[model samples]
Structures are given as structure tokens and as C-alpha cells.
Target: MIKVAFFDAKSYDEVSFNKTNADYGFDIRYYQEHLNLKTVPLAKGADVVCIFVNAECNAAVIDELIKNGVKLIALRCAGFNNVDLKAAKGRIKVVRVPAYSPHAVAEYAVSLMLALNRKIFRAVNRTREGNFALKGLMGFDMYGKTAGIVGMGRIAKELIKILHGFGMKVLAYDLYPDMEFAKQYDVQMVSLDELYAESDIISLHCPLTPETTFLINAQSIAKMKPGVMIINTGRGKLINTEELIEGLRTKRVGSAGLDVYEEEKNYFYEDRSDKIIDDDVLARLLMMPNVVLTSHQAFFTVEAMHNIALTTLESIKEFGEGKPLTNEVVEQ
Candidate 1:
């Protein structure tokens, strides 16, 4: 019997994984705490250890897993930046659920854009307080506006379709351009500079790599058109939070929506409503009415969760059977 230990197991995770495990019959152990060096011993008797996005799988944690006789690290989410692939190389195989539900995240990104543009968040707050005046609820029409998408991945493609429904011109940038898709969607593939200068709304759908980290800093923000709305459903580190605060301070950025943050590991999945947020930049973003922040919930739908659990267990079963690991992440 193959044993798998899951870290950062929330109620939803347990329910989904247990339901899916009925088919696999794997001995799965659940731990509420995230996997770090401190909690490494919990995987002592497991052959495979599964982790979520925020779990710490640094060199130290990887070393402990090897010592514990663990053979594989299965990531439940698509993004694997949290796992140190370099350290796990040649020691333990790392696999992930690459595309559980691109539509879930893409739809959430659109929801953020709609909420910000229509002032839905503020309007809901005002109605609860018995203030139904439309004095400051003015919003511009989305039709005929230009929307710039930073990446041309699966999620971005889903968003492009929705943006087309709104009659918005789509401008996209990707290192490896998919000209066929661009032609199909009638999207203009432009340089990053052109996308920044011409777009009415800029949305990020890229991954967080060494080259793409802090991609939307002060220098990039300066190139953007004044009053350009910015939206990020990508990795948190894609935008420098401090620089974003400065952009919001001035009127340079008309409105902003984010589902991720650079330093979100400390506060995103956990509840800290009773405690004060020590992160100054995050606190400042919360104070801005134009800014809307979600706690990394772009991939939180029931379908996505079910797909994640099914795919994750399937990969583990593949590894157990000595089959080809399709979603394996090698050292880059």
C-alpha cells in the first residue's frame, strides 16, 4: 500500500481528497500545519508527501524529506514556485497539477475587473449603511476599452474570451507568442511597452520566475497610461507592493484589483482578522478604496478542488507504478 502525507490540509482539502481517494486506496495522512523544516518529521513513514502552494519546500525541508525516505513531492496546485526544484533534483521527484481549472481563476480575474470598474464593492457597503446616493458611484463603460493581458496562458485565453464579450480590444504580451490563437481571438500581440502605453486596463496572468519577478515595478508603472486600471491574478511577487502603493497614492493608477500579493504567505490562507497586520504595504493597500484584494482565492472553486485532488492522486499512482510522470518539474 502506497502511503501519502498531505500538509496544510484544510476542511475542503480533506473532503475532496478523501472522496477522490476512494478510487486509489492510498493510505493518506492529513496534517493541518504546513510543511516546513519544523514539521518535516510528520512524513516519517510516508512514501509521498503532498503540499499546497504556501507550504515551505525549501532546501532544508527537502533534505528532511530525503532523510525520512520520502520519494515524491506532489503539489496540489499549478504554481510550484514555493517548492525548491533545484534541491529536490536527483533526490525526490516533484510533480504538480498543472491546470486544474484555468476557468476558475480566469473568471475570478474578470469578476475583480467588473467589481472595481462598477464600484460594486463600495456600492454594497453604502447600501448596508442606508446610503443609496450615486454621487461617487460613477463608472465608465467597459465597451470599446483596451485591455492588456500580460501572459497568453490557458487562464489568459479564458479571460480573452470574456473580454471579447465586453467588446474590449485585447492586447497581449508573451515571451513565446501563439500567433494562431492571437489570429483566432483577433488579439493584437504587442510589445510590453505598447501594451502599457495603450491599454485602459492591464491584467497580469504570468508566472513568477527570476526574470518575471517584480515585473510591475516603478519603472513599468511609469510607462503605463495615467488612470490605467491594473489587475493581477498571477503570482504575488509579479508586482512590487510598495511601488503599487505609490502608484495608488498618486492618481496614476485609476483603480487596481489583486487576488495575490508578494508577501501573502504570511497572511493569505490563515485568518488574522482579530490581529493587526504588521505588513505596512499590505495594510496601506487595504486602506485604499480603489484597491480590491482577495486572499489568493482565484482557484478556490469546487470543480477546481475536485480536479486538483483527482489529478494529484492520479500522479502519485503513476509514480507508484513506475510510469512516466507527465507533470514532473525538473531543475531549470
Candidate 2:
């Protein structure tokens, strides 16, 4: 039987993985700590290692894993930005669940937009204290608003459908244009600059790469309409937090709904409420009335969790059977 070690193992991860591992019967080991260079020794004797989004699978960690006889690196999450593919090129194969329940994230993105626009967070807090005044709770209708989507992937498509249902215009920008989907959904495939200038709200669903790193900066934010709402359900590093804070200070960005942050590695997915927040930008953002932030939980739905576990194990099983790894990530 192939042995596998899972890092960054949470209670939910254990529940889902243990339920699914019964089918494959792999010798699965769970570690609550994140996988890093120092923790590579924990993976000794295991043929494969499974990791989450926050694990630091750098060159040194990959080298040690190879030295420990590890063959494959299976990522439970979709994003592999933290992994160094070049270091594992010839030594260890890497696979990930690329698309698992896109609706889970897509729906959550819409929820963020709605919650921010209608000031739902503020309303709930006031009501809890018996303050039922609607003075600061005024909101605009979404029917005539235009939403600019940064990517046309599966999650963006799902978001487009939801936005269309609310009678919102959809403008999308993608490296590879899908005219068929645009025509079907009544979405306009526009240039990035045009989308930035014309959109009343902008949402990022793109992956993190050299071209997309810090895609939302001062320059891009300058081109956007005044008081435009920005939403990011994609990778954290896509936005420059300092620039965002500046925009918030100047009221250039009316509001923001973020499920991820650029410096989220230290605080996200962990219970640090009892401790002082060291990240000043994140602390300031939390104090803002217009900004709504969630702990990278857009993909935490039951359906998505189950699919992530099933697809992850199925890929490992395929690798063991000498079949093609459909989700194997190759160097670009």
C-alpha cells in the first residue's frame, strides 16, 4: 500500500480525508502543523505527501522530500503558488485538484458583494445591540451596475450567471478570450483597461502568476471609477495591501470584500483572536466600516470539501496505478 502524509491537517480535513481514504485504503497520516523545510523529516517513510495552500513547499523542502524517498506532492487546494515547481521538476511529481465545486467560491463572491454593498455586516452588528436605526444602511440597487470580472474561468462563469440574475452587466478580461461563453451569457469581452475604467464593481478570479501578481495596485485602482467596489476571491497576492489601504484612506475605493490577503499566511486559517495582530495593515482593514474580510473560506462549503478530498485521493490512486495524472501541474 502507498503511504501518504498530509500536512496542515485541520479537523475538517481529517473528517473528509478519513472518510474518502477508506475507498483507497492508503496508509494516510495527518499532521496538524504546516509542511516546511523543518518538517520534511516528518514525511520520512511516506511515499507521498499531501499539502494545503499555506504549506511552504520551497526548493529546500522539495529537496529534503526527494531525499526522503517521496515520489509525489499532492496538494489538496487548487492554488499551487506556494510550491516551487522547478525544484521538483524531475525529482517529485506534483498534482492538485484544479477545479472542485466552482460554485462554492462563485456564490461566496456574490455574497461578499451583496454584504458589502448593503452594509449587511454593519446592520447585523447594530441590531445585535438594539440599535435599529437605518440611517447609515442605505444601499444602491445592483440591477443597473456593471461588474468587471478579471478571469473567465469556471468560477467566473458561475459568478457571471449570478450577476446576470441580478440584472447586472458583465464585462470580462482574460488572456484567452472565450467568445462563445461571452455571447451565451451576454458578457462583453473587453480589454483590461476598458474593464477597469467602465466597471462599477471589479472582481478578481484569476490565478497568481508573474503577469497577475499585484494586478490591483495604485495604477489600476486609479483607472477605476470613483467609489468602485472591489472583490477578490482569488489568490491573496493579487492585490497590494498598502495600495489598497491608501485607496481606502482617500475614498478612491468605496469598499472592499476580500476572502484572502497578501500577508494572510501568518493569521488566516488559525485562531489568533486571543493574541495581538502584528500586521498593521490587516488590523487597520478590520477596523474599517466598509471593508469586509473573511478568513480564506470561500471554498469551505460541504460540497467543495467533499469534492476536494475525493479528487485529491483519486489523483494519488491514479499515480499509484501508473495511469496518467490528469491534474498534474507541469511547468509553464
Candidate 3:
């Protein structure tokens, strides 16, 4: 029986992985704490360590895991931005569930847009308080609107399809553009400048790399259409929170839908309602009515969770069998 250490373990994570492990039967120990220098000792005596988005898989943690004889790091999420791939390159194998359900995130992005557009949460509260007044709930039709999508990944492709059904014209920017997919989906492959200048809604679906950090800064916001809606289901570092707050304060950007925050690892997965949040940037975002903030839950659908558990367990089984890692993330 292979020993597995699971970090950042939530109830949902335990439920899914335990159910899936009935087949593979790997001994998985769940830890509520994150994978960091302090918690790395918990992984000792384990064959592999399973982590999620919030786990800190820095070089230090990687070194400790290697010292502990842990050979594999399995991430049950698509984004590996938190993982130090360079350090793990030669020492340990790193794998992730790249595409559990693109539809889950894409649809959640749409939900955020709808929530911001219609002021659904505010309305629900108003009705419950017997204050059903229809004064500030005006929303423009998505028909004939242009949506600019950054990073034409799987989630972006799914988002484009949904936007098209709403009679939206899609403009996309990608470092490696798929011309065939664009042509097939009636999307225009445009430059970042053009996408920013003309779009009513700007959606980010890019990864967090050195090149993409703070991609939505004040300079880029200045180029966008006034009152432009910004939706980010991508990594939190993709947008600068301070600049975004300024944009919202001045009404330069109309609304925002954020599922990820740069400093989310400290507070996202856990219940922090009882504690006073010390993150001022996040608190500012919470106060804004135009911003619909979610705790990185864009990929929390039951379907996606099941797939993630099954795929992660499968990868672990394959490694134990000494087979080729189909979903291994090789450092570029």
C-alpha cells in the first residue's frame, strides 16, 4: 500500500478522494493545513503528496519532500502556478488534472457576469427585507456586445461558445493562437491592444507567469472602453488589486467578477467569517457592489471534483506501476 499525504484537505476533497480510492486503495492521509515548510514533515514516510491550488510547493517544500523520499507531487487542479516546477524538474514527478471540466469554470464565469449585471444578490436581499424597488438593476443585453477574452485556453474556448449563444462577438488574444479553432468558432484573433480598446467585457483566462503578472494594470485599464466589465477566473496575480480598486472607485471600470485573489491562499478555502480579515485589498473588493467576488470556486462543480479525484488517483497508480505519466507537467 502506497502512503499518500494530502494537504489543503477540504471536506469535499476527502469525500471525493476517499470514494475514488476504493478502487486504487492508496493510503491517503488528509491534512487540513497547507503544504509548506512547517507542514512538510507531515509528508514523511509517504510515497507521494497530493496538493491543491493553495498548497505552497516552493523549492523549500520540494527539497523537504525529496528528503522525505516522496517521489511524486500530484495536483488536483489545472493551474500549477503555486508549484515550483523548476525545482521539481529532475527530483520528483509533478502531474495535474489539466482539464477536469472546462465547462464548470466557464459556466461559473458566466454566472459571475450575470450576477454582476443583474445585481441578483442585492435584489434577493432587498426582497427579503420587503424593499423591492426596481431602481438600480438595469442591465444591457449581451446581444451585439463584444467580449474580449485573454488566453484562448480550454476554459476560454468554452466561454467563447457560451458568449456566442448570447449573440456576442468574441475577440481573443493568445500567445499561441489556434487559427483553426478561431475560424471554426467565429472568433477574431486580435492583438491585446485591439481587444482592450473595443471590448465591453474583458475576461481573463490566462495562467500566472512572470510575463502575465499584473497584466490588468492601470495602463491596460486606461486603454479599455469606459465602464468595461472585467471578469477574471484566471490566476489572481493576473490583475493588480490596488489598480483595480482605483478603477472601480473612479468608475473607469464598470464591474468585476473575480474568483481568484492574489493573496487568496491565506483565507480562501477556510471559513474566515468569524475573524477580522486583515487583507485590506480583499476587504475593499468585498465592499464594492459592482464586484462579485468568489473564493476560487469556479471549478467546484461535482463533475469536476469527481474527475479531479479519479484522474489524480489514476496518475498515482500509473506512477506506482512505472508507466508513462500522461499528464506530467514538464518545466519549459
Instruction: Give residue 39's lDDT in candidate 1 (0 to 100).
Output: 95
* Weakest lDDT window of 10 consecutive positions for candidate 1: 244-253
Q: By TM-score, how accurate is candidate 3?
A: 0.99
Candidate 1 clashing pairs, residues 3+ apart or interchain: none
- Write the residue-wise lDDT of candidate 1 on 76-123 in tens digits: 988999899989888899999989999999899999989999999999
lDDT per prediction?
0.93, 0.94, 0.94
The true-versus-predicted C-alpha distance at residue 116 of model 2, in Å, is 0.3
Give per-residue lDDT, candidate 2, residue 53.
85
Tell me how candidate 2 scores on lDDT.
0.94
Q: Which whole-number lDDT from 0 to 100 does residue 1 have in model 1?
A: 97
- Model 2 misses residue 206 by how many Å? 0.7
Off by over 4 Å in 2: none
Name every residue pair that clashes in candidate 2. Answer: none
Model 1 — TM-score against the truth? Answer: 0.99
* Model 1 alpha-carbon drift over 4 Å, by segment: none
RMSD of each: 0.8, 0.7, 0.8
